[model samples]
Target: MTKAPHRRGADRTEAIMRTTLELGQEIGYARLSMEGVAARAGAGKQTIYRRWSSKGALLLDSLLSLHEPALDYPDTGDVVADLRTQIHAAVDLLAGPPFGPLFTALIGEAQYDPRVAAALNERLIAPQAAKTVERLQAARDRGQLSEAFDLDLAMAILSGPLYFQLLITQEPLTHAYVDRVLDALFTGLGPISRAAGR
Candidate 1:
């Protein structure tokens, strides 16, 4: 007879995820291990390994849980305002404690580990990019953007500077910086037709 899958309570799962994020922030993704997570979470090693195949998987789950709530696309009819809100939310999530350092570590580790790269891309990057694309598409449909606007390129342009400031320049991602980025992008992308006279 086949054995039934083991199910853990939500409390236990939250404990594990909380522990993983804490350790990830403190020690970083490269130094994080399932053993350490299990120990810190007050669970057995097999308990963690049984639930997650690797450290990357565990960390990915924790990261997603922490930041998923803020990943929604805002549809307030003003493309510039929506983009600003989205970008600001992203900066808040990725520039604050626990998530920020954990994200930085995962991104750094992903440079050398394909598994981490894939997980981060799939769980975090791709979804947020898709949301941005959707928002841009909506703007295009509403005649706020040029018909020939490239969504992929738009998303890259919108997000690239934030990541650059976050990871490369190590500069503060302030509100003024967000507004400047939006201003520059909107200037090149053309005026917001729908939001005129406001």
Candidate 2:
């Protein structure tokens, strides 16, 4: 059966996005080109342009695609432990081959272009990150976490240092580094009984 044009278009856009992401990982955002993604996806350049107005838009969608199955924060009913899992997951992701350059590109590019920044936060960050905040909020409701815990602040604790090391210093993010950050965060956010190191 012939797929509807919109369905076909959707599939092609997805393919292009995937191809663009792979290309970004290989070529870096500065060198990423629609022609490369189109050739890799077996589509024409016009097809890519028709769907995405610019490279930033395409890259934004590519980042958003990582969340299709959705990266949920592990809710182990213990906020500290769950946050540890989330932090480790993020560290592993940032250090992973696929996301390293892609993330570096998106974040760096977003810093320069307001439109890209807005689109990225809207289409990518909000969708997946909101879930992280909600999980922490749930812990707050269950009395597993303190009411004073800040989601944005907590998120900063989790990913900010990693991004800085990766982006600013251009240092490698390793498992040891991941564990260290989580260790410190858990130190502060640990249960009241353990927060005092009982």
Candidate 3:
């Protein structure tokens, strides 16, 4: 669908993005359009064009903005507990409105659009996921982890079950699931040993 003109470049772009996500939530991405976002955002067409220049770019920012900074990975001293916290954070995000359906729709769209794939990877994957990798690296360096640790495998183990429960089973990601998943993953991951009574 065609969107009306946007407000202006920077502020306009953000406004459009804000409006786009709102519209996306109200009406599924299938029905999304620049016009709807612009109208709702009170932006101008030229405003959006100046910043993004393409629907993919605009949509990318729109989707990315949903990630609040606090949602990013936390580097707690205890990796297992940290991983559990991260998993629970994901569940909390999925269980909420706009993120689950919005991200799911974006994932489906990414399959057909290479740009979307790259954008998704850059915005969502890199920041939070890379932090996990960094944490794993730290664990390895401290000799707390097995030499055979596969980072990719480790991350998958930490996150896979949660995704299975939330994405596949479409079940609620309760605290129980979080605890269970973390326990299973930690058993295989091999967290660093702690001193007694430390």
- Cα RMSD to the true fold for all candidates: 4.7, 3.5, 6.1
lDDT of 3 by residue, 1-198 (tens): 645555334455566788777787888878887767767877777666676645656677876664553665566677777766776776666656656776666666777888877887787766767788888888777766765779877876767776677567877768787898777666766744456226
Please say which candidate is ahead in lDDT: 2 or 3: 2
Best by TM-score: 1
How many clashing residue pairs, candidate 2? Answer: 0
In angstroms, give how far residue 46 of model 1 lies from its true place. Answer: 3.4
TM-score of each: 0.82, 0.78, 0.75
Candidate 1, residues 5-76: lDDT per residue as tens digits? 444466788899999988877887778999999888899999888877778778878878755746687799
- Residue 183 displacement in candidate 2 (angstroms): 2.7
Counting clashing residue pairs in each candidate, in order, gives 0, 0, 12
Worst 10 residues of 2 by lDDT: 63-72
Instruction: Report residue 99 deviation for candidate 2 (angstroms).
Output: 3.3
- Clash list (residue pairs), candidate 1: none
In order, the Cα lDDT scores of the candidates are: 0.81, 0.75, 0.70
